[model samples]
Target: MGDLVYFLNGRKAEKIEAVTFADLRMQESDIEEILRSSIDMICDDEESMLIVGQQVKNEKNGRSDLTAIDNNGNIVLIEIKRDRKDIEGRKEAFEFQAIRYAASYATLESTEDLVKKVYAPYIEKYRSEFELGVLTSYELLIRKLNEFLRVNKAGKSFNKKQKIVLVASDFDEQTLSAVSWLNSNHVDMSCYKLTPFKVNDEIYLQTEKVLPVTNYEDYYVNLMDKSLATIVKRNKGGTRRTLPKIDSMLDWGVVKEGDVIAVKDRDNEGILLANGNIMVNDKEKSMQSWLKEIYGWSSVQTYVFAIHKESGKSLSQIREEYMTQQAMEASDDF
Candidate 1:
């Protein structure tokens, strides 16, 4: 649980203090919050759902950082790095090292072969349990992913989510951004941003959405001030270019082409999107319903129709056009 609090400068900052996952196990109550938040990012999609952290163990060989058991009962390798050191130099190298560890251990022709070859005293400790759990304060995400693939037999299946997550007080911006960009290309993988905050001298952890939430279409729309498509497109680039038309800009499943979305009435003003989430000046039916159904049609349709005809193109298309026009005028700031 993260809370927002004023710092010495009255600015906000998460209070991690001396907490570090390397010294704590996932089962610890304090680490549970970080695990919950970080796991959300790793399990953002289906492939990631079956893959989890602390399910892997790493040999003391100093070569491998962590190890995990994939769904298929195979081995997955991992490496942890949290330093700002130039030794590793490249992020991809860390990922590749884990792959290499798995590759080496993968030479076993079968489960029996794996037992005879890679399974050491330590690995055998958890062999009967059929899973390994490892945590490094740095980043064990690479292991999380490898373990997921092994557990799920990813390549053999058409499944798409790659489960992996890195938990830290503040991770490297480059790695975070890269992981984010990669996450957008597929739903199988995701990342989470955990900001620890202290409010009234109490530390709380807050979970922020990093990927586009399909269910809360309106909520995200309002939060990001962009249409669902725009949000999805920016994160997950795909060929599904179904932009909405002008009149259907306010219709469900449509983008209004504007960068920002706002809802207003006589008394209060609020911002909105397709998801049922919002930020409003006041909580009122006029405001709540409008925010909840920001892209929906109702009595408001009459006014919209008076301005623009249905034309049989579906409300989505019409709304898209209108939104696009507004979006263009608003610029890309919002």
Candidate 2:
């Protein structure tokens, strides 16, 4: 008879020689190895480009683990845990150890040094499948780390924000709660569960839940949608201010004064006297309301009439001239 037998996923139970659960939990490295092997499945379709190593030591703190880089040259710090033991507690060990590793390589400057130090020994000493894997991982980490550092120095930090990653088989309530709390507080991080299952005596690693990277702030989705829509709108039209400008005009009462606005007509022979005075086409009502808010409507009308009288042209003619001038100026940019 086999040592142990258990129903797996409630599908046609099979009895076989069971590896001791204690043996599985005994060596932390074994669990780490499983995760290291499972990374391909874990990182699939995620921002992660290439995973460098499982337990990358941080030179600065002398204590750290998983480090990776994404396709866009962003750094990802990972921490792995199998289960709880008597030493320092499981979740605590995973969290703090990863944080220490993350802190060591938190900024771009330190990440490069850490990458080299962790990979150099492996690159020099080994010659096998694992060694080749390490080499490939090192190359990825170095390339991205260098590129990320270069971009950071050039003020591209927003696009290269670091991601702290945690991978584990099981997390206790405390660990999950802590993670959720950190996420709520706007920490840039994510957690993944790695599970190993046996089918016909062959072990296979599977990736479970991939947690949200960060918490949702008020109007965050709306703001992101607005930003993407603005970019698309810009590519489509040569003359469209963003939705934000319209928003500001309505919400903040900011007068819509372009640097050199354009109002166009069929004729192109006149000077653009009404260039700076033009606002958005739809803001006339709210703009007039603002004018009334600041000064009376009669004052605004008088001012408008005075501008026309002084220029010796109708408002329409002034606008057409302004648009013609703007058309000429816009062509100069190309």
Candidate 3:
């Protein structure tokens, strides 16, 4: 069993007593309630994520624990299993259910579709519990969704990218191996073990990511990138386009030799230095490497905005104008 024991400071190490949920009379519903109320406690990026729906129904007539959208526009499906023993007989069942929900969610075409289909039901179901005279639940939800898109500049379609989070008190070897393999292949899957411990009168919850391991996260991310690159290459006649060199960007006046540029899309972002080296989420990379790392395909273009260290223009504004100019030039060429 997963647990934590308190230690007393002394000349000799003394093992303080520790207790489990059974001793405290805590139930599965308690964990679920805590998670549902404050999901950020478990999500990887709380600032960029919005929990838009709960107990969402899948096409299979089953309910998903929670559904969220991140700033990158990736759909996040979270499933919670109260304790290690609770998943004994139904280990595969939870995985299958999460997969079904992901499959269904992958069909969503746009954020609007998500708001209308997934979030609307949640708003309506809980409308009465919210405060009035301010924004209505529906309006508040839309504002939150739009704000996320505006801040992230994530344009709609999250169907292609999905993240599945499986939370349980403990995961057996079988489930851990399965999720680890899936994460390495192409699925962005994570398993979190939430263990509860009690000492005296206080209860402490410990959450650990048991799958993929924290140190190996980048390795799995690279593997998934390679897999996606392969898929993109295969789908596009097995040819990968070369990204434009830094000189071209400089000549086009999009970026100067010493300027820092942020290349972004609805789901990801990469930073390019004036010296031609690129960085995605702080990891140094080359242009082609960053493109492949971010979008899986070089031909898949995204918004590139020059960051002016001394200017008042926002990155989003810069990106918007750049896109507008590109659209106009494309129209003229057409």
The regions of model 1 sitting more than 4 angstroms off are 1-41, 45-60, 63-65, 69-99, 105-109, 113-165, 176-192, 199-334
lDDT of 1: 0.36
Of the two candidates 2 and 3, the one with more favorable TM-score, higher being better, is: 3
Estimate, for each residue in 148-176, the C-alpha lDDT of model 1 and write its tens digit: 34434553432211233333333343443
Clashing pairs in 3: 154-266
Q: What is each predicted model's overall lDDT from 0 to 1?
A: 0.36, 0.44, 0.61
Per-residue lDDT over 1-334 for candidate 2, one digit per residue giving the tens place of the 0 to 100 score:
1223355567767654434324455355676565454444445321223445545545553544555555444566766665433223643455555556666555445554556665445434433433245447667545544653442242244225566767765554445445556567666566665555555656655554434422323212343244532332233221111112233322322222332222111121211122222333334333222332232111122112212324455333454465577689999988
Instruction: Report model 2's TM-score to 2 decimal places.
Output: 0.46
Comparison by TM-score, 1 against 2, better one = 2
Candidate 3: stretches off by over 4 Å: 5-19, 45-47, 128-136, 214-334
Q: TM-score for all predictions?
A: 0.32, 0.46, 0.59
How many steric overlaps are in each model, in order? 48, 1, 1
lDDT of 3 by residue, 1-334 (tens): 5255555657656554445555568776677667766565564311245667788887768788888876577888988876657677674666666888898998888767898889888768767644435876667667657766665567654556998989887665556556756766778887777777665666777765555543333222343244532322233211111234455555667566545554443344445566666666677775544543443221222223223333434343554566689889999998
A best-first ranking of the candidates according to their lDDT comes to: 3, 2, 1
| Candidate 2 Cα outliers beyond 4 Å, as residue runs | 1-26, 59-61, 84-93, 110-115, 125-160, 213-334
